[model samples]
Target: MSSLEQANEVYNKYGAYELMKRGISEGLRHLSAPYENLQTEDQWVGAKYYGNFAGFHNNFGGNLAETKCRTASGNPPQIETTQESEELEAAMELRHNGYTKIGNIYDEDVIDEVVSRYNNIIENKEHTKSSHSNDPGDGNVYIRGIDSPQEEYFPEAEQLVTEKVKNILRNYYRSHIQIRNLRAYRTHHIPPELMESKEVYNNHWHCDGKTSDHIKLFVCLGETTEEDGPLHIMPKKYTREYAKRNASFDRETDGAPNNVVEEHGEPVKFTGVAGDVMLANTQTCLHRAGVPDEGRSRDLVQLYIAPSSEPLPENWIDSELEGADPNVWSRLLKY
Candidate 1:
C-alpha cells in the first residue's frame, strides 16, 4: 500500500491515543540527552513530527511532557538584576495568557517619524518587496524593505526594539532570543465584491505552524480603533477548548462558528493608539486580522522572534535581525 494509505489506516485504527504514546516516547528520549549534546537532525525530526504531535495532544488535552522538556532544555542561566515591576508583570501575563499589551511605550516623536516614512513609501510606490505581493494589494500590504532601508530614512523604527521589550521576550522564552524577521504592514478594508471569494490576509483564525516557542511583537504606528482593523485573539485556554471540540489544528479558514464562540469565550480585540506594543505567542494562540471598515486601514510593525543561545545585541534591529525565514527548530535545540 502507499504511504498515504498506510498512514490513514494507522490513523483510523489507533487515532490520537497512539499518536500521543509515540510523541511522548520521543519527547522522553529527547529529554535523555543534554541540550548541548543534542543532534540537529534528531531535533529536526522530533520537532517536525513528535513536537507537532505534542501540539495536537495539547489542543485536545494537556501534555506535561511538552512543558517539562521545554523548561529543562530551554531555561537560561539566571542573571542578576532587579527587573522593572511592570516588565515583570507583563512577562507573567504573557506566560499565563499567551499575550500582553503595553500602551504608549514609544514617544510621540518616534511614532510620527515611523508613520511619516510609511506614508512616503506608500505615496512614492517605492517598496518593491512584500509578503503577499511585490506591490501593495487591496487586502494587505506588508512592505518588506522599509526596515532595512539603504539610506536610513527613519531610525526611530528601531525604538520599537527597546531593552524592556527584549527583557519581556527573554523572560517569555526563558532563554536568549533573536529577531527572526521584522516588517511593516497595512491591512485595508476588503472590497465587498471580493469579500466572499477572496480571502482577506490572515482573516481566518489560525495558529502559526512554526515551533511552539515563536512569538511576535506588534507595534501600532497610528491610532487604531475598531474601524481600523485591529487584531482579535482568543485566550490560550479558550483556544485549546475550541480546538478540542472542533478538532482544529493550524488553520480554520471560516473562523469560529457561532456555536463554538458561544461555548468558548469571545476573542479579545487589540485596539489602541500609536506607540502601543503587543506581544503574542502566535504558535499557541488562535488569532486573526480584523477587516477594516470602508476607507479605513491599519498600519503596524511586526517583529518575529525565536529562541537563541546568544544574548541579543544592543543594535539587534539594525544589524542582527535575520531574514523572514530562519532555522527556528535548530535554534530551539541550542538552549
Candidate 2:
C-alpha cells in the first residue's frame, strides 16, 4: 500500500482526535489535521481559528470534497532529523538575520546521480521551439520523473532533498502555515542570454495565490550563478504594488506583465548554489527566471503547500472519491 493508504487506515481505526493529539504531542505539531473532516461546514469554520483553508499536504483525507476530502498540504513530519544539521542551522540564522544561504544539504555524489539521469532524457527541444511552451532560455527544458528514484542513481535519497526542504519550511512557518506538495520541476531550457528574461516561457509577474496561500520553495539543482541564469524575486514590500496590475497565474492562460519597479531602485536577483531553496511568499512576491546560458544549466524542484481552511475550486480534478492518484482518472472522467 502507498504511504497515504496506510495513513488513511490508521486514521479510520483510531479517530482524528487521537491522531491529532499524537501528531501534535510531537514537535511535529505542524502535521496535525485541524478537523476530523473538512467537508462539513462546521469543520471548515473551525479551520478559521487555525487561519487559512488550504490543506498542508494537498491530500486532505483522500480527495478534494465539498463535504468529503482532498490532498495533504505539508511534509511528513515523522521523517525528519533528530536535530537539524549545521547547514539547516545556518539557513535559520540567515532567515532570521534578513537573508542567507543553506549549504551542503546535497553531497556531490547525489548531484552526480540526479544529473546523470537528467542528462539521458530527450531534451524538451520541441517544447522550447514551440511558442506554446517556449521558455525564454533561463534554463534547459527536460521531461523528468517518468521512471525515477532509480536505486543506482541515489538509492539512499529517495525523497531526501524534498523532505529536507519541507522540514525547513515546516520549522520556519510553523503549524500556522500548511505545506501542500513537493514535486521536482523539470525545465528544458530558459530563454535567451539576458539576465532580464523575467518570464522566459511564461509572462508577467504573478504568484500562486489563486490556487494557494502557502509559500513556494524553489530549490536549485544546478549552478544559479549570475550568468548561468537564476530566479528573480521581487521583495515582499513590492508585491501589492505589482499584483495590482498583473493578469494571469494559471499556466493555461496568458496576460500582461506587471511592471514592478522596486522603491530601492533595482530588481532583486535570487541566485544560489545547488540545494539552496528560495522560500517565496506567493501572496505578494513576483518572481521570474533569469535567461539560461548554453554553458550554465539550471534545474529546480519546487514545493507548494497552504493552510487547510481555504475552499478548493469547485471543479478541481482531484475532487473525486477514490483518491487523489491519477490512476483513478477513468472514474473521474465520469464526473
Question: Model 2: residues >4 Å from true position, as ranges?
Answer: 1-101, 122-158, 161-166, 176-179, 182-200, 241-259, 262-265, 293-296, 307-335
lDDT value, candidate 2, whole model = 0.41
Query: 127-154 in candidate 2: lDDT tens per residue?
Result: 1222234434434342233232222322
TM-scores of all candidate predictions against the true structure:
0.68, 0.47
TM-score winner: 1
lDDT of 1 by residue, 171-219 (tens): 6666676776777767777666665554547665766655566678988
lDDT scores in order: 0.61, 0.41
Error of 1 at 180 (Å): 1.0
Deviation from native of the Cα of residue 334 in model 2, angstroms: 20
